[model samples]
Target chain A: MSCNIAIAGVTGAVGQEFLRILEERDFPFSSVKMLASARSHGKKLTFKGREYTVEEMTDKSFDGVDIALFSAGGSRSREFADAVKKAGAVMVDNSSAFRMDPDTPLVVPEVNPEAIKDHKGIIANPNCSTIIALVPIWPLHNANPVKRMVVSTYQAASGAGQAAMDELALQSKDILAGREARCEAFPYQIAFNLFCHNSDLKPNGYNEEEMKMVNETRKIFSCPDIAITCTCVRVPVMRAHSESINLEFDSPITADEVRELLSTAPGVTVLDDRENNRFPMPIDADGKDDVYVGHIRQDESIPDNRGINLWVCGDQIRKGAALNAVQIAERLV
Target chain B: MSCNIAIAGVTGAVGQEFLRILEERDFPFSSVKMLASARSHGKKLTFKGREYTVEEMTDKSFDGVDIALFSAGGSRSREFADAVKKAGAVMVDNSSAFRMDPDTPLVVPEVNPEAIKDHKGIIANPNCSTIIALVPIWPLHNANPVKRMVVSTYQAASGAGQAAMDELALQSKDILAGREARCEAFPYQIAFNLFCHNSDLKPNGYNEEEMKMVNETRKIFSCPDIAITCTCVRVPVMRAHSESINLEFDSPITADEVRELLSTAPGVTVLDDRENNRFPMPIDADGKDDVYVGHIRQDESIPDNRGINLWVCGDQIRKGAALNAVQIAERLV
Candidate 1:
């Protein structure tokens, strides 16, 4: 099948990843359009060794576009998503704008690929941390129904954008050189320091980032009855995100069984080498497509082996956002 | 009473911290002896504007010492602890070698100062991460017992040693300057990356650092019935450690009550400002003696209010190690 694609917000971090992934995967496309804001209009973006000038996104930018991948902020997606759909194009949005909407399917292709068929012109991509987490969690839950899941995220600055990544580098240099750290991209220093996720705290006392994990996981897994809680924190890492997850099952399970199951699971890699002290580090997951899982062990606190713990790392830009949306687009054809 | 003190492993990271804390707190001592390995013997160290030479620790080094604070490795403590007691000095050892010994009292002054009276001759300081966690956990457990606890740590390089801290600095510079990070102090690059704690893994699949948090908290709190599990990871931060803790209680508790309880608690500070996103960060806790606790909220995943979540940060060198040992020594006098 021939395809024409448009990448909205093509100059942002995740947008850049969107272009690179398409080129590297040799995605077949009859035409490609790079769309960005007016500030980035006319900016040259090189994809597949060919230069394409970024067009200013507007109501009509999706003309003749078969699929529109949206990674701009939530407001932009909310404003332009309908226009894309009105132009007879499917929109795979990477923003939180429509994720919780009952009509918009919140999809992690690996976890809920069938949900794609139910989408009414727009399929919502899960949050980066949520996408990285559920990719491994869904397989485990399918084997043994998880009664409860607790997640603690070690997120990276790239989740904010390319500007935050630049801030981290600049702050680290200034701090090392005995100067005050610049704090434009973040509220405080992001160099050699860690803080709680800087999202707005809801009335329930959970931050927006944490609640997104709780809400989006329930939607994608189609298991609102599953007990889930998450604590999200930002560490000083550049791109990849890490999570320490604890899962409680309705029935007993063993870590060895978990390793065996994930070994054959798509988009999963096991790196649990206890003797060598080698596990999934963020560096190992950066620039990689697969979610790295390790430190898988039985939670000894629970009786009858009814619980398991794991550490997972994934490239937030790849498996978390742009690549996930692209994977959804791949299924459309 | 005036006392003659000896600091074992004075050349190490925690040992040097011991001296700074002693002077800062104005610990009562008539004279102080600096003891270290033969390689560091005769090295000059200044304490309170007084110069002292580090003596090679031997069987006779504790002769004139009344209270000997040991921050050396486990083997060094085991090799010299008996000698310290034989010389009539009360030994406050900060190594795991004696922490679990039934004969030795494992103590966190804020949590279990009464345990100091049960010491045969040695008082063992709990692990750094354990000490930081139990400071705030004890008060809540006193109000209403904790049935289960799940702890995930964001530890710093200093937990490994001074050399590890140096390696983190050097590696960050190298990576930023477009060079491969040097990996002498750690098995992997610790710049812009994180991994499972480097401590040896036990047969049960828990790393030693994680087991230390579990075993030490059980001993210090004197609550063996509480189910505790921990996952410890090394972040790129330099000195302070952060933790995301989930606590399950026997009865329901409100976040407001927790804030009230911690406000009056000793050596604890509350920083939960939800409006401005000003919860505790590592930089805020660095060089501070208090355990900064915040992000207290109900775990909504539970059907009832039987769960509470918290974020805590504390200087691993100050309250976690050396100051904790000094506080134990203060109780002796």
Candidate 2:
């Protein structure tokens, strides 16, 4: 079950997370290669008590690699996709570059692992918010079909990359010291303030981050006709992303039934406690593998009891990106 | 039309906002009385460039006062309601003590100034989140008649009071310096993090903050049967509250039409500039009176263009509390 692995963008956030997760899971690997751009070439990174020097990625970098995990960026993924396939290495891309390509299979291990079987050398990882939401939602969807969904996301700084996370910390320090916060990572100050997702707006008035939730959910569920809308805003939190989701089902579903179903679902941890008012929070999901689900309740607005509301949080770097890509690679062996 | 005024709980966060707003707006007043709990007795406060001593409120404190403004806790508001009424003063309360009371008219000046006329010697201010949401929604509902609403709130520390705001600052400082953030004003850390609104959870699985949005909107709109649901969360922001709102109309509506209707609506400022990708942010509404509205778009989840989505932010202390109470008093003159 051992494979030769190459991690592209090894110096980035998700790339760093991939190293941690692979080591923690004791992933069977006969050999490993760390690849990055010229800027990060010769950089030193340690994994599993072994030090390695990062090398510049090229078309021939994946010659003997059995699997290549690409998180450099969309452009990098697009640039290397053909080369990885030509070298016969499976590319588990954590970017939007190949997600919509008919040849690439978009996958969330818990929700659509079967889609991995049809991948044409590249498997795409769903968006962070999309993966966090669907992990708990998929179980409910199987019990009672979801007809419509309205979601509002409280996204974290990590989704933008390592630089954005550093910017949040720096801005927080400067603002606390009464200095003006610097704004290079984001368009506005992200210290104690939040804004709508900075992704380019699509023609339909939805931001790219939001449309990904809409399109990717349909793709993952293989249910294109389901109605979906999303509002994505970046919050001040550091790593985990949280979502407030409302769902309309084809038939009546109670809150207890949802709690019961998600309680046993894989990759989900139910943190609902009404008496002490304890529920899932970003701090609870930071660096964790499980998506925390709570605030489960029947939507009172829907008269037929066909509506449900859930609050979800998951690590944007782990389950949202690196861990998901690794899990897909796990099935390959 | 100037009248004598008395401010109860004149030492808290909302109390300070009340003084600043009254002075900024050039409110008409002949004389002013500053009242607080025994803890604040003999404390000196400056109002309109004049110094006044805070007096301990008593049953006779409201004597000869024309309009009494109350921002004390709910228990204090209940304890002094009869005293203010017995002294023949009209009370404008900024607490939940009388919001649901049938005899007391819950009012948001921008949405339901008419409700003030039905007050039986007491007018109640709606919840901060409710007021911020309704100011923008009222204009839309008038044009198209809203049939349902789904709202998610990004509440600021100010909603919990001055102490909570201070805790957020102190925790941010402590955490930035590699120290554990002390949790006192809130059950969880409010530094660079968020959690579900810490208000008491109802039996129906909704917190008091969320239910206020549901119940208050119905009362203010004078439409009890309107379907409404809300999810409220507390972010690390300081003074302003932000909301993501989705509305379903009785018939089809366009985003441009909704924006056109709200452009001239009182107490609302449309800040949607899609070209710049700048929509409403909490900082934009921090010290401002108007509720800033942006991200106006059609809800793709709904059919026939019957659904519209909006992002709104407003100063919780200004429009959500003191300013709203003062506006109700303005109508009495």
Q: Report candidate 2's fraction of native contacts.
A: 0.77
Q: Against the correct fold, how does model 1 do in TM-score?
A: 0.99
lDDT of 1 by residue, B95-144 (tens): 88998888999998888899999887899988889988989989999999
Clashing residue pairs found in predicted model 1 = none
Tens-digit lDDT string for candidate 1 (A151-222):
999999999999999999888888888899989999988899999999999987899999999999889999
User: How well is each residue in A1-333 modelled by candidate 2, as lDDT tens digits?
Assistant: 899999999899999999999999999999899999999999998999999999999999999999999999999999999999999999999999989888899999999898998988999999999999999999999999999999999999999998999999999889888999999989999999999999999887889999999999999999999999999999999999999999999999999999999999999999999999899999999989999999999999988999999999999999999999999999987
- Most accurate candidate by DockQ: 2
In model 2, which residue pairs have backbone atoms overlapping below 3 Å? none
Q: How far is candidate 2 from the true structure (C-alpha RMSD, Å)?
A: 0.7
